[model samples]
Each structure stands twice: as C-alpha cells, then as structure tokens.
Target: MAWGRIQTADGRTLSGMLTDTGLQPMTGFGSTTPAGPVEALDGATLLAPCQPGKFIGLWNNYHAAAEKNGLAIPAAPLWFLKPDTSVVGHGATVTLPPQAGRVIFEGELGVVIGTPCRNASLAEAEAAIFGYTCINDLTSLDILNADPAFAQWSRAKGFDGFGVIGPSIATGLDWRDLTIRTLVNGRERQSYPASDMIFSPAEIVQHLSQDMTLMPGDVIAVGTSLGVRPVKAGDVVAVEIDGIGSAEVTLA
Candidate 1:
C-alpha cells in the first residue's frame, strides 16, 4: 500500500493510505486504526510523505558512479544529515539561497523507518523499514567545494527546501528491480538502477543503527548515481522511482 500525508482544507495534516479513490485517513503512521472519511486527492494538498526526525543521506553508494568518478568503494556507508527544515513536499518550491551558487539536483531512493532501532541485526533492520519514497537531494555545489579545508556537506545540502521527497511511500516494493530517474525541466538527466548500489538498504540500516538509534519516520537517502548536474531558477526537478511515485520541486 502507498502511504502519504495530506493537508485538508481545514489545515489539518493526516496520515493516510493513498488509494485510487482518495486518501483513507489512518490514526497514525503504520496504524491499524482508521481515522476519518476518505479525502479526495484533488481537494487536499500532499505533504512530504513522512516527517523524518533524522534525515540521513549516503554518499558514494553506487558502483557505476564510483567507477565513473574513480572513487574507491567505501568500506562503509559515507553519510550526512540534513536538518528537518530542509524538507519540502512534492509540488513545493525550492527557493535558492541568494549567496548559494550553482545548485544541483540528485535523484535518490529514500528508506523510511517504521520502528525504533538500535544496533539492529539485518533482519531486524529490514523489518523496521516502513517503505520507500523518492528523494531529490538538492546540493549547493559551490558552497560544498568553496573551502577545501572543510567540506560543508550539511550546510551545502541542508538549506531550506533542499530535501524534496514524496508523492507517497510505497510498501512491498521489490527495490532490487527498481530504477531511479531524474529530470530537469522535462529533460532526463539521471537514470540508474538500484542494483548498482554498493551497500543495500538493509546493510545501511543495520550498520547505521549500530551508531545511532533510528526512530520511526527517520529517512535514509540511498544516494544518487551518475548524471548529476546543475539547475537554475525556474527549473522543475523531478525524481522518479519505478515503484515509488514521482516527486517534483520547482526551483525559485
């Protein structure tokens, strides 16, 4: 089933299952209790599928991108955190910071946590996973490489509205067979297979869980592959996954 958060006309955000007919409100995320009547999709506004307490992003997780850039396969997942304020829902506008030069869009798969986990085994970590969603990990390239002394990874990617995710989180997906594609202003820029990942989702969760506890609604961006490029103002960026729906954000 596909899960999402929708904002009704009354300004209440509800967790629900996205159905062909509309949204069936749930008591909570992964909740068995039904909340209220179905809200038609057209009448409500979609929010980021989930509000992740921790927004973790991986780097150099794809074999193809590593090979192309002559980057060594990391012994572990190289990760960074984006502040919660960076998150924006699909159809939201991503305003570029005035001093932030040359921003780029990275399309990646997002792993949504369902249960709290710490030092979890692979099976436990897998079970803790709620579903997967599409993420556009927008980065300010100029700010990132501005000072070679220290890589400002978080600052570069943690700007307001930089973390764009959702249309919905899809459960029961065969992630291995999925592909991630990114488009800029209607033109394809990135296309890669999830099979190219150096560290699978389960491994990432299990390993990261050993270091920090992952709570429900935490998101782990599996990272991007080749063909990442810059985007300017007015460009509409879309991240599409085969099973998960597309998430689009317009640059302003």
Candidate 2:
C-alpha cells in the first residue's frame, strides 16, 4: 500500500493511505489505530509523505559515481544532515536563493524510517523501514567548495526547499530491485540501478543506527549516481523511482 499526506481546503494536513479508489483516511501515520471516511484523490494537493525529524543524505554511496570521481570506498556510510526546513513536497516551487550560486539536482532514492532505532542489527533495520520515497537532493555546488578550510555541506545544501521528497511512500519494495531516473526540463538526465550501491538500504540504516538514534519519520536519501547537473530558473527536475512515484520540483 502507498501512504501520503494531503492539504485540505481548510489549510490543514491529513495523512492517509492512497488506494486505487481514493484516499482511505487514517487516524495517524504508521499506525493501525483507526480510519476516517474515504476522500477522492482527484484534486488533493500532496505534501511530502512524512514530516521528517532528520533529513540525512549520503555521499559516494554508489559505486559508479565513486569510481568516476576517483573516491575511495569507505568503510561505512559518509553522510550529512539537511535541516528539516529544507524539505519541500512534490510539485512544490523552490526559489533558489541568490546566495546559493549554482545549484545542482541530485536524483536519489529515499528510505523512510518507521520506528525508533539505535544500534539495530541488519534484520532489525530492515524491519524498521516504513517505506520508500523519491528524493532530489538539491545542492549548492558553488558554496560547497567555496570555503577552503571546511566543506560547507549543511549550509550549502540546507536552504529551504533543497531537500525534495515524496509524492507518496510505497511499502513492500525491495531496494535492490528498484531503479532511479532523473529528468531535467523533460529530458532524461540520470538512469541508474540501485544494485550499484556500495551499501544497501538496510546496511545504511544499521550503520547509521550505531552512531545515532533514528526516529520515526526520519529520511535517509540513499545518494545519487551519475548525471547530476546544474539547474536554473524555470527548470523542472524530477526524480522517479518505479515503486515510489515521482517528486518534481521547479527552480524559480
């Protein structure tokens, strides 16, 4: 089943399951508590599948990108955090700040955590996943390298609307079986298989758990492969994963 959140006409947000017929309203996300009446899906505005407490992004996780850039395979995942404020829902418009300089769109798959996890085993990590979502890890390429003393990872990537996530969350997908494709201005820009990853989704979670506690609704972007490029005003960049659906953001 797929889960999503929609904005009501009254300016409130409602979480529910996306059914073929319509949306089956649920009392809360990731729970079997109860449900409300079914609503038509025709014109509802979609929000990011969940409000993530932590927006984590991985770097050099894919072997293809790593080999191309001559980066060494790391013993564990190399990651950075983007503040939750950077998140924008599917179809949202992102105003690229002037200070951002040149920004690039990184299409990647997303893993959404369902339960609290810390020091979890591989088996437990797999069980803790709620579902998957599409991600566009928009980054300020210039700012990232502008500083000589330190890499401004968070500052370069944490601007509002940089962390693009979700049209919906799809459950029961095998990460290895999925492929991520990116389109920029309606042209195919990236296509890669999840099987190219140096670390699998469960392993990513298991490793991260050993370092920090992961909370429900937290998102971990599995990282992008090749074809990451700069996007300017009026450009539409979309990241689509077969099971999870597309998350498109416009630069303005």
Candidate 3:
C-alpha cells in the first residue's frame, strides 16, 4: 500500500491510502488540514508523504559514494537533522532563496519510522519501519562546504522546500534488492543498488536509536551517491526507486 497527504479542491489537507480504487481517508490523522471523505487522486494536490517530527539524515552511507570520494565508512551511522518545514512534495516548484545561493539535489531513499523507538535492538528495527519513500534532499552547497569554522550542514540543508519527499510511501517492499536512480532533465546521473549501502536501514536505526529517540513519522534519508549535480530554475529532477514510486520536482 501507498500513503500520501494531499490538499483537496475544497482547500483541506488529508492523509489517505491510495488503493486500487481511490484515496481513502485515514482516521486520527494529524496534518496541515482536517480529515475528510475519500477523493480521486486527480482531485487533490499531493504533498510530502511524511510530516516528520524529526528528519534525520545520513552521511557516507553509500559505499560507492564513499569510495569515489576516498572516504571510509565510519564505525557507525553519521547523522544530521533537517527541520520538518523543509519538506515539499513531488511536482512542486522549488523556489531558490537568494540567501541560500546555489543548491544541488541529492536524490536519496528515505526510511519512515512507524513506531516510537529508543535504543531499539537491530532485530526490532525492521518492525519499527513504516515504509520507504524518495527524497531529493536539496542542499545549499555554497553555505555548507564554504564555512571555515563549521560545515553548517544543518542550516545549509533546512531551507524551506529544501527537502523534497514524495509521491507516496511504499509499504512492504524488499529494500535490499531495490535500485535507486536519479535523473536530471531526463539524463541519468546516479544509479546504485541498495546493496551498495555501507550500512543497512535496520543497522542505521539500531545505531541512531542508541543515541536518540525516534518517533513515528520521523524520516531518515539514506545518503545519496556521487553523481549529485546542481539544478537551476526550470530544471526537473526525478528520483526513481525500483519498488517505491518516483518523486519529481521542478526548480523555479
């Protein structure tokens, strides 16, 4: 099953499951809008699949990317946080903030936490996952790598619409065999199998939980590969994961 949040024609936002039939309202859903009846997929504007309480991101998680840069995999998952407000849906135009400077897209696979977990064991981590989704993880490269004192990755990554997540969460899929590909204006840039990850999702959760609490709806973006490139106004980026659907966005 796939799940998404959308704004209806009536100007209300809802969380629903996309069935073979249509969108069905989810109970007790908390989002930018109130719950409502089922609607056609064509009747609503799809938003990011998650309203993350905490958006955790990984660095050097992909073996290929790490090797390409001549960096070694750390002893554990290296993590950072992106604020929830940065999330934008697929197909939405990403406006470049003058202060942010030039931004680049880091297409990645996102893991959605299904249940609250603190210090979860490796064996239990899989059960805690809700599903997987696609994330662009746009970054302001200028501010990020330029700072001499600090990398400022957090600030460089949390600008509004800097985190692109969508079109829906893919549930019950075999992630290990999945392939992640990134395309810029229809030109393939990055392609890698999930097997190339230095750390698996379960291992990542187990490691992260040892230090912090992971709440339901929290997101973890498994790091992207080495083929990341800059995108400008009018450019379209598409991230395609084998089982999880593609997420596309346009830079404006």
Candidate 4:
C-alpha cells in the first residue's frame, strides 16, 4: 500500500492511501480508519508524504561509489541531518539561495519510521519501519567545500526545499531489488541498484537507533551513488524508485 498527504482543491489537506482511482482519505498516518471521501488525483496537490521530525541522510553507504572514490567502508553509518524547513513535496520548486553557487541533485531511497525506537535490535528496527520513498538530497557543493577547516554537511544541504521527498511512501517493498534513477531535464544522469548499498536499510535503522530515538515519521535518506551533478535554474530533476514512485523538483 502507498500512503500520501495531499491538498484538495478546496484547500484542505488530507492524509490518505493512494489508489489507481484516487486518494482515499484516512483518519491518520498508518491508520486503517477512513476519514472523508475519496479525492481525485487530478484535482489535488501532493504534499511530502510525511512530515519528519528528524530528517537524516547517510554518506558513502554504497559500495560501488565507495570503490570508485577509493574510500574505505565505514564500520557504521556516517550521517547528517536536514532541517524540517528544508523539506518540500513532489512537484515543488526548489529555489536556489543567492549564496549557493552550484547546486547538485542526489537521487536516494528514503526509509520512513512507523514506530518510535531507541537502541533497537535489528528485528525491532525492521518492525518499526513504515515504508520507503524517493528523495532528492540537493546540495550546495560550493558552500560545502568553502571552508577547508570544516565540512558543513548540514548547512550545505539544509536550504529550503533541499530535502525533497515523496509522491507516496510504499510499504511491503522488496527494497533490495529496487533501483534508483535520476533524470535532469529528461536525460538520465544516474541509475544505480539498491543492492550496492554497504549498509542495508534495516541495519541503518538498528545502528542509528542506538545513537538517538527515532520517532514516527522520521526519515532516513539512504544516500546516493555516483553520477550526481549540478543543476541550474529551470532544470527539472526527478528521482525515481520503481516501487516507491518518483519525486520531481524544478529548480528556480
């Protein structure tokens, strides 16, 4: 099943399940109770699938990319956080801040938490997972490397609209078989298999949970592979994961 949040034509926001016919309104996230009537997709605006309290992004989680860059695999997840304000839904416009010189798009898979977890075991973490979604972790590369003394991972990627995620969150997906593809202005820029990930989604959740409590609606971006490149104003960047669906953002 796929879950999503959307704005109806009447300007009402609803949480619902996405179906071929339309969105069937639900009482709440992960709830089986119906709230309102089914809404047609054509008349509704899709919002970010979930509002995450903590938005985490992993680094160098893919073996292929690690090998290509000659970086050793880490024993644990190397991560960063993106502010909630940086999040935007599918079809949203990402404005390039004046301070940003070169902005790049990273296509990644997002793991959404369903239940609160702290120091969870692997089995517990697996059970706590809600689903997966697509994410475009936009970065201001220029700002990232500006100061040699420190790598500003958070500041470099936490600009408004930089944490792009969701058309829907897909449950029961075989994430290992999924592939993440990125396109810039209709041309394919990245195509990588999730099998290349050095740390699987479940392992990431278990390990990270040991560090901090992961609440419901928290999201973890499973990092990107090679082929990430800069995008300019007017460019439309799309991140697609077969079962999870695609999220497109236009640069402004």
Q: How many pairs collide in each candidate, listed in order?
A: 0, 0, 0, 0
Error of 1 at 3 (Å): 0.3
Tell me the TM-score of each prediction against the true structure: 0.98, 0.97, 0.94, 0.98
Across residues 53-121, which tens digit of lDDT does each residue of candidate 4 receive?
999999999999999999999999999999999999999998999898899999999999999999999
| Full-model lDDT for every candidate | 0.93, 0.91, 0.85, 0.94
Worst 10 residues of 1 by lDDT: 27-36
Give the per-residue lDDT of model 2 (tens digit) for 29-126: 78755477777766777889899999999999999999999999999999999999999999999999999999999999999999999999999999
**Regions of model 4 farther than 4 Å from truth:** none
Candidate 4 lands at a TM-score of 0.98
Clashing pairs in 4: none
Error of 2 at 252 (Å): 0.2
Model 1, residue 196: C-alpha shift (Å): 0.4
TM-score-best of 3 and 4:
4
lDDT by residue (50-162, candidate 1, tens digit) is 99999999999999999999999999999999999999999999899987899999999999999999999999999999999999999999999999999999999999999
The whole-model C-alpha lDDT of candidate 2 against the native structure comes to 0.91
